[model samples]
Target: MKNVLLVLFLSISMIIIYVFIPQQQSIVFQPNDSNANMAYIPTKEETQFKIKYTHSIHLTDVVESYKITPSKKIHQYELMYEDFSIGMPSNAEEGETFEVLNGSYYIKNMKRIFPFFHLRIGQVRANHTVIFKNVEYPLSHSIPPGTSVKVEIRTLNFIDLWKGVNILESL
Candidate 1:
């Protein structure tokens, strides 16, 4: 009888612990560093061709959405043609200081130049509709002509929940 009673008590205690204890919640951001983790900012170079048309989309639509409060401060960064290439390099210089719209096209910067600049439209957390070039796309869609598109990022925090953590670290 004593053993049975002890087991019951322990089971109840464990249940209580599980119910009341809160999971650790963390805030993550993208482009973690302002300078693209580079040692110094590179000189701004002129582009050969004019930017014909630009369509912007928010990150929340492309990537898994997270809660963002209005009170959270937004940080801005700009990516120009010279800073990014086809494939992302290990040591790319992230530029500093630019005006970025919160709900717009999402683009990433890399050290080397590539043929196409990757772009994503729509985010899970997007509150309103995003109309680009007179057409409406789904909640999330990949933008084509990656070469012509420029990317700007606006976020409350730079740490991203999904892409921030290293896959190996979880293991």
Candidate 2:
């Protein structure tokens, strides 16, 4: 009788821990450390997100669009930049399209996939912006300067989401 009761108890505990507490998926910008205050949760969609930053030397805007696959891999689809100077890409690789539209250069049909990428917040000139859900956010507002944030998708529970940062409250 005691053995059966123990098994039941364990099963219930496991269900409560795994099922009772719901999990939410979001693109998390976690810094080098486990400092949740420095982290940012931009969106819950596993569809698309964008990172826009200004060139340090040229001071022109550069936008990179990424799509999150169903398997959680990040797929870079397009890149838009002001010009072709100061380390900017001149032409697209094999099968990619390089075109000019409205005085800007666009490299479309990108096929680069990565598990995750590190984004080091610029101390001086990099005005990095996170755009998703038709909104733009200033990344420098939450994280400290020069912090290398690991950008990835994380399945966070309520406690984790509460601890992490969310800059979309007003919207």
Candidate 3:
């Protein structure tokens, strides 16, 4: 009787902990308006991801590399683009370095940190794609074109993860 009771109690406690406690952190993309849906990609600290998009004006590729900090903040550490015009940044900020590497212009050591930011998916020409863990997730796959999204990091438990859409569904 004692052995059976102890086993039951331990099983219940584990289930409760798994359901209520946050086990992992993920990069969550929340819709800015009513036009889109929410999605998430499981991630961990020190993981690197890239948002690659086509420049609306220059028609070139622009890659923004980011790394998640230990505190779960988004750290944008590098920017790579082909040209400088219109909305493109002409030079690196005070502490960053601008250099040309392998025919592409790179702004290394950007050190831009953001708790959250707004991303506007391109309607026509811009194909905004997120590469996480070497998997490509195009926002337009699950979200409507031209939809604006709020990007943020969130800690989630199994229940929350089950409720949210996994952007990797398309993969």
Whole-structure CA lDDT of model 3: 0.86
Local distance difference test, per candidate? 0.28, 0.81, 0.86
lDDT of 2 by residue, 1-171 (tens): 999999999999987787547477677788876453645554565388899999998999999999888877789999999978878999999989999999999999999998889998888888788887768887877677777889887677666667777756523
Candidate 2 colliding pairs: none
Which candidate has the top score in TM-score?
A: 3
Ranked by TM-score from best down, the candidates are 3, 2, 1
Instruction: Name the runs in model 1 displaced over 4 angstroms.
Output: 24-96, 99-171
Candidates by lDDT, descending order = 3, 2, 1
Off by over 4 Å in 2: 1-22, 33-38
Candidate 1 lDDT by residue in tens digits, 1-171: 999999999999987666555332222112322322101111123111112112233122322111222332212222322122333222325542322245333333322333222223223333222222233333122221111222322221122322233211221
Q: Model 2 misses residue 155 by how many Å?
A: 1.1
Local lDDT at 50 for model 3: 91
Model 2 TM-score, 2 decimals: 0.83
lDDT of 3 by residue, 1-171 (tens): 999999999999999999989987888888888645577888754378999999988899999999887778899999999988788888889999999989899999988999988898889888899998777898788677877889888898888788777887865
- Report the CA-based lDDT of candidate 1 relative to the real structure: 0.28
lDDT of model 2 at position 82: 96
Cα TM-score per model: 0.23, 0.83, 0.85
